[model samples]
Target: MDLNLRNAVITNVTGNTQDQLQDTIVDAIHSGEEKMLPGLGVLFEVIWQNADEQEKQEMLDTLENGLKKQ
Candidate 1:
C-alpha cells in the first residue's frame, strides 16, 4: 500500500471556502488529536508555498513568539 498523506490532506480540503477551512483548522487544533497534525502540516505547506517573503517572515515571527510562551 502506497499512501501519501500530504496529497490526501490537500485533496480533502481542495475546494473548501475560507470559513470552512477556518472551521476545519480551528476544530483540528481544539481537538488536539495526533492524527490532525499531518493535515495541518499540509495546509501550512500550501500556505507557505503561496506566501510572499514578508508573509513568511511574519509567520516565522508569530511562530517564534508562540514557542517562546511554551
Candidate 2:
C-alpha cells in the first residue's frame, strides 16, 4: 500500500465511531509474529494510527487476499 492510500484509509476510519480501534490495532501488531510485506507495513501503520469497523474490514480483506497469494 502507498502512503497516500494508507492515509486515505486512516482518514476514512477516523470518520467512524469505534473508540477502541487503537488498542485493537496494537493487539493485532503484537499478535502477528511473522514479518509483513514492506508495502503492507504502510497499511498496518495506517490501521494502528486510525481504524474503525469498515476500514478494518477492508484492511483485513486486503491482507487476507494478499496472504492467499502466497
Best by TM-score: 1
Instruction: Provide the clash count, candidate 2.
Output: 0
On residues 1-70, what C-alpha lDDT tens digit does candidate 2 reach at each position?
4667667555655655455565545655776754434324664675556887888888789889999999
What value does the lDDT take at residue 5 in candidate 1? 82
Number of the top-ranking candidate, with lDDT as the measure: 1
Q: What lDDT score is found at residue 3 in candidate 2?
A: 67
- What do the candidate models score in CA lDDT, each in turn? 0.91, 0.62
Off by over 4 Å in 2: 1-46
The residue ranges of model 1 lying beyond 4 angstroms of the native Cα positions read 1-3
Q: Model 1 over residues 1-70: C-alpha lDDT tens digits?
A: 1248878888889999999999999999999999888888889989999999999999999999999999
Residue pairs whose backbone atoms clash in candidate 2: none
